[model samples]
Target: MRAFLLLLFVFLTLGAAPARAQQPTPTRVIEALYDQLSAYQLRRYQPDSGYQLLTLPSTFSGPELAALRLRERQLVRVDLVYSAYRFDPKFSQRQLNIDRLRNLDERLPGLLMDPSITWNLIEQTGCTTPDECQQYFHGFVLYIEKRYTKADTKAEIGRLTARLNATEKKIERIRAVRKSPGKPLACGYPHVEDKLRKLTKRIKKAYDCTQKDRRPRTVTFQAEVSRQGKVLNVRLPAVDSAGAAAPPCPEELTGAIAEGLAFTDGFLLGKQRLPFTVTGRLSLPLRPQQGFKVTGYYLADSLMRKYRVKLLRDGCQARQLRPGDATEEDPIPNPDPNVVTRVLERHPDWQKQTVVADVTGSMYPYTADLLIWLQLAAAGPEKTFVFFNDGDDLPDKQKRLGQTGGLYDARTNDYGRIRQRVIEAMGAGGGGDAPENDCEALLRAHQLAPEAQDIILVADNHTFPRDTKLLEGTRLPVKIILCGVTDHINPKYLALARRYGYSLHTLDTDLTNLSELPDNQITIIEGVRYQTTPGGFRRVSGRAE
Candidate 1:
């Protein structure tokens, strides 16, 4: 069946589909490959020949005899390339492998040598298994090393020196410019309310009052702000330390002060996210002789937010922080639901169940509970999880807009990891109309994992799936566990259950031990579908299971 779909995809992509002149999308083309291939094979794609052909303009011919023949040949050449990629899947895979190495080399020039954590494998490899990706990455590293010699390193160093010289010259020129009584104002300082509060809080916890103070009691610094409010320089007053060891002020605390200042509106030249180095003074009131200049970099606002008090404290005794006070920014603002409690209300047999869930912020509470339950339940090792963002879909008169979320395999046996990595990333933020991409996600999940018999979907009950075609097809009986919503159940979900012989289950996380709750708006009795309009549940057209 998948083979057939791949062939049809090839035909359509080659501009060979009858009556459908429009070209196939990259997503659909990939989906076709997914339909026929194993997960390992998913990484492979035609780098040189296949992708080029797929991107070529469709064939066109006119009345001129010579020109018409030429056009036909051009079309055939391109179609043949497309055919090779589609028909012989191995060719495409080879292309993808070649492309991957080249891409890695181009993007991260010194990837193997540079042990920086900047290389994000998941984003780079597009969600491949960790082992497969690492294997490929290491191979590419070796390939790069074989050619990168001492001469190459020397040449790179020379280039860096030249760039540095040029930068220094530019800085001199900028500094040479005559200034007014005050530095040029970039603009009104942008509000740094959050950053300012955080900096103050960090400064207050310089020492653990409960424990004997080991380090500096006070640190003071002066900052030079750029036109755009970035911290260009930080300097401490020359301390009157009589040639002795300075008070040890933590670098982390001063660094936050610099960044918090940078985030504020300075001169406001042109807005930019940039780095600046600053030096500040350290002081200890108890030991006046211990004081010195400290130097550090001002971090980008976003990067600064991630600096944790716990980690920064390092070996220092932790100052007792206020219980309610937050040391870290709240995870994408939304109501926090205890997913574990909700999942416990009706403990699930996790074995043999493929979990499909909506992770949108609105659904986070319910989704969180589901994940907590998954963590607690000693489920089968076989279960696969799939997550998707609800994106735009079309219907008759009404249009669902702003829906653009991609599907990612967010499944893991380690439920602990899910809570930390996946759940923490979920925010009440997304695009697309009020409705989500549940239909598309389910369809994709179904295609990805055909073996899992029982499909359990954690869905938002507020909106229905616009793509009804997914329901029209042959499918497993789904258990649509409606979460975060109850009064309303999108009729389409019911339609899905009705069409595919699945059952509907709604959980009011607030209520205990509830099961299989019905929608308040629409009621189904026997085999009839009825919607509440001005009147109530008058039998609608479709059959209700």
Candidate 2:
């Protein structure tokens, strides 16, 4: 009795044990597949409903079963967990694995019969583990090796020859299209009715040429047609023969073709027709070497020159010129003696405007002139001056205003303490090779004066990644004036200006002497002239209009 009870207790304990601890229900494989499918859907034009996931055991097709087996090998842990729990509560873990393995073995042979479906199955399932994937990969390698060996037999020889013949036929078709004379005939056939007729005729000619054994020849011709629709001159420039066996066509053939085209009213009666040229080519498969060419001519016709122009009377009415016209004067009125005097006489509210200076590299001379003009204007504490730089390093030590030198001498100096302060604010500490993060600099500037309106960036428009980031993030209305930069302004800067509703000024030529630029709205000022030689400075005098 005691032995019987012990044996029964042992059997019950074995049956009640949990199914291999459930293995954390590995969901990573399914999640990864879902993510990949989502990414593919982003680029797909068709609806997602077209794709369907195949279930295992009964519903899976031969190719799908083979692919699953291959995936199972590569994604070993994930596949094992999936196989163990695919049917869940209906079947035990051991039963599920056995059923999947049996079904996979049975379906693989049928899957191998169709290579395209096999390829599709393998491609769709991006197996995560290596061992499981290598099983299917090894099978593919063996199959390919066998296929190549079979193809080498005498019976398969004709199949390979047939493929080559098909390829040759395709090449012949392409050559026919390339050498066709339709392109020349279709040129400038603007009217719908005329275009359709020309296109139809060209297609018929191309078909006829392809049917003949003689290869097509190509000829280029330049000609001039008079207003009365007569050929004035026609000459051949180049001739490409259809084939080596074919003789070159005479140049007279091209001339004849051009004469025919000229009388067809294709030439526009321009004041003088720019030397227009066309190529005439005969498309043939056998005689590709035969072709002709033609060259230049003049057209005599009633030519009408098309010119567009517009005139604006006032600066406010100027349609073409914007706020940042480079040739025009500064948009903000300069605080120079002459400009301030005119402003006082006209509106008497001349003192409210503010002045900002970009004391960056190569801008010292302009900044000095600006300061001098501001002093001359004398706005009696109403005028404000702001300074900034491309760099963002703080100064080592702050200098006393008058301790270093007299205020007059210090103020007159171009690149002195004031310039140093601007450089310090730019955070110029990471050596000379440090990248200038313009986005950070712009953000810092805004933080300093958030209330300021109409910020002007007076620097060369040499942009970087930081500039793009700044433009994308900020909504500030900032206009850019390219001072000394002549070429290669970064496109990102232009895009940023457009996005932020700002204007761009490209200043390459001289701006100090012009009284009035083509743009009437902007105000121009005469700054100091720049020279390469040492101690070479000249003053330019010009009145603003």
Best by lDDT: 1
Q: What tens-digit string does per-residue lDDT give for candidate 1 at 314-394?
A: 221122223433332231111223433444345445334577777654454465456534543454464567665443122
Question: Compared with the true structure, what per-residue lDDT tens digits does model 2 show for residues 1-545?
Answer: 34334433432443333312222212332222222110110111111121122234334567755664442221101111121112234545333333433444344422211111211111213334555534332111111101112223222334323433454465445445433212121112111222433533433343343343344444344555544445567555543343343224434344444434544443332222233233334333323233221222222222111111111222111112223332211123333323222323343432223334444432433443443333333334332334543232322122121121101111222323433343343222211111123344444445555665644444433222223334565686454554433322333343344445555545432222221222112232232221111111111121111
Point out where model 2 deviates above 4 Å.
1-358, 380-386, 389-441, 462-468, 471-473, 508-545
Superposed Cα deviation of residue 544, candidate 1 (Å): 24
As a TM-score, model 1 comes out at 0.30
Task: Candidate 1: give its CA RMSD in angstroms.
Answer: 27.7
Candidate with top TM-score is: 1
Candidate 1 C-alpha error for residue 310, in Å:
40
Stretches of candidate 1 off by over 4 Å are 1-352, 379-382, 391-405, 420-429, 488-490, 508-545
Candidate 2 global TM-score:
0.23
Query: Residue 240 of candidate 1: its Cα lDDT?
Result: 31
